[model samples]
Structure formats: C-alpha cells, structure tokens
Target: METCGSMSPYWVKLNASNCFIGIINNVDCPENTTGLESSTVNLQLTAFAFMITQIPFSVVFGLALQDTENTFLLLCGGCSILVFLLFPISGILAFAGCMLILRDYPDLERGWSFDLCLASSILILIEIIITLIVTTVMGIRSSKRKSNGKPEESVEGKGSSKDGDTQTQSNSYGHSIMKFAQVAITNGAEAAKNAIGMK
Candidate 1:
C-alpha cells in the first residue's frame, strides 16, 4: 500500500502513483531496481509540495481581488514568478526520474499513465500563463486608478493655495490703509497748531 499527501487531489495522486508504478514494473536494469523507488518518491513529493504551496497563494489572490491592495497583489505576483520557476524544475525532475526508470527499455509503450501526466503538465502550464496575465492586468489597472485620482487632489490643493494668497493680500492692504490714515491725522494737527501760532 502506498500513501499520498492529503493536500493533493485524489485523482492526481492516483494518476501519479500509477505512472511511477508503470515505470518500475517494466524496467529490468539493476540500477533502476535500486534507484527507481527513491526517484519516484521524490517526484511524488515534489508534486505534492507544489500543490500544497498553491493553497495559500490561491487564498491570497482571492483577497487581492476583493481588497485590491497593491501589497497583496505584489505578493501574489512574486509567488507567481516563484511558481513559474518551479515548473521547469519539477519538469526536469519528472523527466530525470522517468528517464532513469525507463532508460533500459526505450521501446516500452507508455500507457494511459503517460498520457495523463502529459495532459496534466500541459494544463498546469496553461494555468500558470493565465495567472500571470491576470496579475499583470490587475496591477496595471490599480496603477491607473491611482493616477486618475492624483489630479483631483492636486486641483483641490491649488484652490486652497489661491484662497490663502487672496487672504494674505487683503490683510496687507488693510494694514497699509490704517498706517496712511494715522499719518494724515498727525499732519492735520500740526498744521492747525502752526496757524494758531501765526495768529
């Protein structure tokens, strides 16, 4: 009896197990006999790990969509890139493991297990492509929204500054008028005193 991680879908786990079993059953080489088990185990572990990592990413992406926060979006993008990097690594691991298992029997017929794995790999790649596109589009839209909002704020700021300038000018004019009135009163008192002295 073989055990699979609970995180992976049952069908995927079943198909992956079948593929490994198919490879191990057909090859008669001594090295394959010794190494095939470990390689297959590693392949399964890698697939499970990939699936496990996606769960949190899926949750984060969903939140990003609702909240539309750039921080969340950025995190999701980083995760997408990381996952994109992992695809090739996982592919290479799968290829190496399969090759190691089937090196002795090049002519062996790959049955349904191979077909399943191939189809799943292609679908996974397509999914990754779609995810990257969506994340980029979302990020672009978020930036556009921010840009659209900035001009309105700037306009309001300009209006407030103009009002402040008008108030400052009015205050300065009032002060000057008051000073001129005081000087005129002083001159009038002096002129009246001079006229009285002459009389």
Candidate 2:
C-alpha cells in the first residue's frame, strides 16, 4: 500500500508488513515509523469485536439467570451481567485507544477489531433485509389465500343455492317483462278505440 500510495506519512502509506505488525501489536504504524498511538492500541480493538459479537452472549446470560436450580448457571449468569456492565468501560478504553490511533492516522483499518465490527454490521443488515422480504411475501400470500374465500357455491357455483339465486332473478325479470307487455297492449287498444270515438 505504501508503494502504491503517494509518499507521505499517513495511513494509506502503510505497507503490508505494517498492517500485520500494526494490527497484531496494536501499533498504529510500522515499527520504525512514528504514526499514531503507542503499541497497545491494537489490543484495545478487541473491544470492538466484543461489542459486535456479544448480543447472543447477552441472551445466553439472560437464559442462564432463569436456571434457578443450577448454582453454576446462576454464578455464570451473574458473572455475565457483571461483564455486561463492564463492557461500557471497556468501550470507553477502546474508544480512547482508537482516538489515539486515529489522532494521527487519516483512514480506518490497521485495526483488527474494526474488521469484526464492520463484518457483523453488514451481516445484520443483510439478515434484516432477507427477513423483511420473506415476511412480506408470506403476508401477501396469506392475505390472498384468506380474503374473499367464499365457497364456489356462493358465486354461481354448481350448487342448489346458486341455482336457486339464478332462477329467482330470471323469474323476476320475466314477470316484469310480461307485465310491461300487458300494459302496452291495453294502452294500444284504448288508443285505437278512442280514435273511432268509442267510450
């Protein structure tokens, strides 16, 4: 990276060896190079990994607390709670350490814990998107399957009830037509008689 990058003493100027050394030893720059914080900065990044990875541990601790009959489980859960409380202090330390590392360095990386944090964040986002897609698909299918699901008999299905409805409608229509024809015929006869001056 240092070879590829322009020749200045920034993060991008780091070589591959420096990455391994800086990340492992928690140093911000190469051994000879005076970049950022002291050597212990890398160790502090362990906090980042824990921060991203401890969700399941929190659940486990909660479950452990529920085990009333098991003394060992209770002890473990209590310790876990203690650790959880301590996590913030640890984060503060890591933040301070990271700030020290970042104080001079312009870019991220050369930090091992950052990798874990980034990876976990991306994984969570992907999981959420997939979950939402599946849920939406299922919901749509369920609603379509559930809504307006009357039996075939309700909508001109081949059942006695459907047949009855159709028959009733046709019969009423026929009756109306017959009555109208009768009225028309009676009016025509009356008009013809009147034209000839009959009562």
Candidate 3:
C-alpha cells in the first residue's frame, strides 16, 4: 500500500480523478434516493389539483343562484354563498396542508409550485368568461324584447286604453301643441326670410 505522505505525483492525480468520478457516478445513479421526497411532492400536487377543480363548480353555482328569480334565488343564493365562501376557505386549508407537506419534504421540484399557481389563475379566468357569456346573452335577449315593442306594464292599469273623452282630450292637446309649434316655426322662418330680403 502507498504511504499517504510519500505518494507519487501520478498516484495523487489518479486519486483526485477517482474522487471526481465517484461524485459523477453518484449523480448518474438510476435509483434516486429521494423516492419518498418525490412521492410527497406528487401528493401535494394532487391535493392542489383537487382544490382547483372545485373552484369552477363553486363559481358556476354561485352565478346561477344569483341570476335565479326571488324564491329560487333565496335558496340558490344560500347554497351558492355557502359554496363560494367555503371553497376559498377549503382551498386555503389545502394550501396550508401543502405547505406542511412541503416543509416535511424540502426537496420538491419548484415546477409544481408554478403549475398550481397557474391552475388557480385559470380557475379565475374561467369564472370571468362564464360571467361575461351569461351577462351578454341576457343583455341581448332584453334588447331584442325592447326592440320588438313589448312595453313593460306596471302593476297599475296604466297601459289600458282610456275612455273616449280622455282619448279625445289627449288627441286635442297633442294637436294643439303640434299646431302651436308649427305656427311658431313658420313665423320664425318668415321673419328670418323677410330680414334676409327673400320672397
């Protein structure tokens, strides 16, 4: 065996090379020693995925309940409020759970964090899209009805036809207003024409 203090220059170089090769071999090993760590990371991602999936259902139900008529609206609103309120609370709980998992397993890939964040952002985007679509459809339907001359009636009998005397009085009033406006306009035009020396 070579003595440590008196080792040849060639032997020293070979020992250094061997130590470097061992590090490289360890890095290239097929069996990762961090299997438990990877599984923990995967579990966290799976949990986050479940939480994200619940968001859309909550948003849809909430909006649906909000758009419902009075009686149904109350029921739907209650359920929707429960869901909308609970989903975030649950999501925060899940995130806390994930953080605990991450604390236990610090070797997790950073990529999963970005992916979970992206999924949450996508859930918000989907809710906005759904809201826009429902509102747009309702607006179009309302405008179409209005353009079709469907006059919305009040609780009173305001839309009903009046008695003949009332009708005659209204017609006479409208005719008088129109005649007065026409006479005023004609007189104004005549005055302007006379001032301008026009026949």
Candidate 4:
C-alpha cells in the first residue's frame, strides 16, 4: 500500500513468512519503533494451524460415516465435538488477530491473504451450521420412527386381548344355559309324579 502525503510516497508491506510488517518512506518519514507482539502473531498462526489440521480430520470423518462398523463412527462422533468447537474459535481468533494487526499498523491494507482467510472462516462456519441442522433433523426422524413403532405394537396387543375376552364370555354363557335347562327338567318330572300319587 502506498500513500502520497504532499512530499513522499509511503509504502507499507507485509512479509507473511517472517510475520513482519515493513514501512518505507522516500522523504521525511517518521520511524515507528514498536513491532507486533509475539502473542498476536502466535494467535494468528494457531488459527491457520487449526484450519490445516481440520482438512484431514474432515476427510476421515466423512469416511467414517460410510463405514459399516459402528466403532469408527462412534469414535468420530466424540472427536467431532472437539473439531466443531475449534473451527469457530479459530476463525474468531484469526479475525481478531487481523483486526489487531490493522490497528497497530494503520498504514497497512488488508491484502489478499486476509481476504482468503476471512472467506475460509466464513465457509467453515456455514458448514458447521449445516452439519448441526442435518444432525438434528436425523435425530428427530429416528425418534419419530421409534414412537410410531411402539403405538402400533400396543394397538395389536389391544386387539388380541379384546378377541380373547370375547371368546371367554361366549363360552361361559353357553355353560350357564345348559345348567338352567337341566334344573328345569328335573323339577317338572317330580311335580308330575306327585300329582299322579295324590289322584
């Protein structure tokens, strides 16, 4: 970045490899002795490191989802929590680091590297949101299936119980009718014999 201040062209440049910001002035430029703090640079570097590490981790996670065995998928699920936490945190840290860098060096312009990192952080955040939504939907669907299955089983059981009760009631009614008929027949025969003897 260059700025013309009525006398000389001031230039600001960043060296990413060495983590240095350099300023150049052709005529009558004030010297700034203060340099970027080590902690700020470390924070920025850590963010990039995490972004890099997530690449292989993400690939493995995708592969684990396709695996038929539950062990790998279960392990990935535990590790995924940590990965999810780190992504947003790292992105925020990177953004904070860039802001601090710009604050300390007002002449510096955010270059292509900053733009790229910003874009990457945004994309990663979006991916995280999508992943969460899908996981939640899948969980809700599975719960629905389980709930639906239980009611069907209960309904079948109720139908079977009703049928059994109807069968038992019919059998008892038939036995009671037969016992009544037998008692009436015996009383009639006795009354007839008594009448004949009296006559």
Candidate 5:
C-alpha cells in the first residue's frame, strides 16, 4: 500500500512534467514541423496506465460473472493481489525508467510502457477466463447438490452453533454457496482495496 502512496505523487509529477514539456516543445518547434525533434518528449505515456484504469471495473465484472465458490473466488482474489503488486511496479518502472530507456530508441519509453500494460492485460485476461470457468463449474455443482436429497452442508453446519435440525434446515445448498461466494468476494475485494490503497 505504501507503494501506491509513493507512486501517486510520482504519477502526478510525471504527468505534469510530461504536459509541461510537451507544450514547451510544441510552442518552441519551428512552424513546419515534419518530424519529432530531439527535445520533444514523444516518449511520454500516461496512456499505458489506460488499461490499469479498467481494473477496478473489471473486478466488479468478475464478481458478477465469476463463480462464487471458495476455490474460484480465491482464484479471483489471488489474481487481484497479483495485479496489486504488478500494477505499481509496472507503472513506476514505466514512469521512472524513462530516462534509462532514452539511451536506446527515441520514443522508446512509450513503447516500454505499452509493453508493460500489454503483459499485464494478458495476465488479467487469463485470470478472468479461469474465474469464469471455475464459477460455471461451481454453479453446476451447486445445482447438482441442490437436486440431491442430502445437500453439501456439513462444513457450513459444523461452523454454526445452532441445533442439528435448525442448521440443516437453514443452510440450503443455494444459500450456502451464495453465502460463501459473498464472503469470498468481500474478502478478496478488501484485500485488493487495501493493496491498491483504496481502503
């Protein structure tokens, strides 16, 4: 979470500098500007963070479409944590490492930033897919459990202090799955928020 706090100011500085530099470069450029000059900051890219903006929204989508079972929800949570780690690293690298990359190709910083975002996007896409499959399987298993005379209630029932009959009656198959799913999502969201410094 400290990473997020530290990176926020850098992000602001990077953007402000990029904008200020860009305006100065454009205004200073001679009238017929056919190509980017050496002084031009073409490598500036807050664009790479474009995909990053989709993350919180994507998690919401995942929660809506993903399986709410313990395993799958865990998967989603794990994915979110991974993103939490990678998000800051990639952003900081893209923003702060610009000078290092400038030694190579001109405007290479933008390319590097784009590449980082692309890699992160690929990982996130895989996470979303796995979550979808796991969720579907969970839904199917839940349906099967419901149709059977004895539902999958042992674990949930054991946790409760209620009497045998009351526990059995209260924890219906659908209810159990929904409850666990809600819990899993909530925990995962909390973890992600904490990691992102959203909380």
Candidate 6:
C-alpha cells in the first residue's frame, strides 16, 4: 500500500519488484500528465486553475473599472468561471467513484473507461460553443454601432469620419470667417487713422 496525500481521493501503491503500479483513484488528481494523449486533461487542469485564480481577479478588476457596458460581459465571464470550476469538480468526484467501483470489481470494460475520458471532452465542447455564441453576438452589436455613424473614438484621440471632405470643408469655413473678421477690423482701423490725419 502506498502513502496517500491529503488532497488525493485515493491511495497509490507501487510494486516495483513485480513492475506493477496501482493508483486507487479515491482522491482527485488535479495535475495531469503533459502529453498528447492527455491534452484535454492538461486543458481541464489549466481551466480549473484559472477558475480558482483568475476569475476573482477579473471580477474585482471589472468592478473597479465600474463599466456599465462590460457589466453583462463580466457577469457572463464569472458564470463561465463557475461552470469551469463545477464541471471539473464534479468530474473528479465522479471519476473517483467510478474508479473505486471498478477497483472492487475486476471485470470492467475498456469502453466504460473511454466514456469517462470523453466527459471532459464534452464539457470542453460546451464551453467552446457558449463562448462562440457570446462573442459573435457582441461582435455583431459592435459592428452595428459602428455602421450607425457613431463610431466610438479610440483612446489615442483618433476618429473615423463618415465623409472626410465634409469635415474638412466645415473646419475651413470657420477659419475663413475668422480671417475675414480680422481683416475687416484691421481695414476699419487704418481708414479711421487716415481720416483723422486728413482732418
């Protein structure tokens, strides 16, 4: 029998003399092997970590900014984080139960194990679908706002013009009117001086 870690749900035993290693999957293995076959495992692990670490940070940051435009998005992101957390947690528990059941009985089919592996895969697909729909809707709304001639100005003080020449002409007309007023004033002052000198 192998010593069990407090975090692990199951005990692990290795019989090196007989080249046998058995993991009694009672505890959750939050860390997965880093290899091609276990890529989903790694992804789920990373997502779980993000749920625990990044989600709260993101929520706090969003609250600090206090942006009404991003309120819905922040909430959705928070829900996604919750889903990520719950899915893996439930999966780990289910996997642990299944392992314990299989350990007691020696005649489990390979197909059942395959099904267990696919659970995480299905959850990942669901996450992807949800993200796609949310992002697509946001993108469409943004495009619509841009097309309505109310394009949001960038932080760097750059703006898009619906008609460049129209803006330029408007600016030019204001400048011309100011110049004409100044010239008129100067001419009137000169005429007054000439009249006084002649008098």
The 10-residue segment with the lowest total lDDT in model 1: 1-10
Clashing pairs in 3: none
Task: Estimate the TM-score for candidate 6.
Answer: 0.30
Which 10-residue window in model 5 sums to the lowest lDDT?
A: 5-14
Error of 1 at 16 (Å): 22
Model 4 pairs whose backbones collide: none
Error of 4 at 83 (Å): 1.4
Q: Residue by residue across 133-154, what tens digits does model 5's lDDT show?
A: 9999999999887767344465
Worst 10 residues of 2 by lDDT: 1-10
lDDT of 1 by residue, 82-191 (tens): 76466555544444444543554455444444444445545565666787899999999999999999899889989989999999999999999999999999999999
Candidate 2 runs further than 4 Å off: 1-12, 15-21, 25-36, 39-63, 66-70, 106-199
Please give each candidate's TM-score.
Answer: 0.45, 0.34, 0.30, 0.45, 0.26, 0.30
Instruction: Sum up the clashes in candidate 2.
Output: 1
Q: Name the candidate, 1 or 2, with the larger TM-score value.
A: 1
Candidate achieving the largest lDDT: 4
Note the Cα lDDT for every prediction shown. Answer: 0.56, 0.55, 0.47, 0.62, 0.47, 0.47
- Scored by Cα lDDT, where does model 3 land? 0.47
User: How do the residues 1-199 of candidate 2 rate in per-residue lDDT, one tens digit apiece?
Assistant: 2111111233323555544233333235545754335443453545555554467668778778778787857677767776665455444545455455555555544443443333444454465568679999999999977665755435545577777889999999999999999999999999999988964
Per-residue accuracy of model 3 over 56-124 as CA lDDT, tens digit each: 757756576667366766656566566554444433433443454447535533333333443453454
Instruction: Provide the lDDT at 166 for model 1.
Output: 97
Collision count for each candidate, in order: 0, 1, 0, 0, 1, 5
Q: Positional deviation of 56 in candidate 6, in angstroms?
A: 11
- Candidate 2, residue 39: how far the Cα is off, in Å: 5.1
The pairs that clash in candidate 5 are 67-135
Q: What is the C-alpha RMSD of each candidate to the true structure, in Å?
A: 9.6, 13.1, 19.7, 10.0, 28.7, 12.5
Tell me the tens digit of each residue's lDDT in model 4 across 1-199.
0011111222224333323332222223235533345665566667767666677788878878888977888888568657857877777766666566667667655444445555665666677789889999999999999999988998999999999999999989998999989889899899999999999
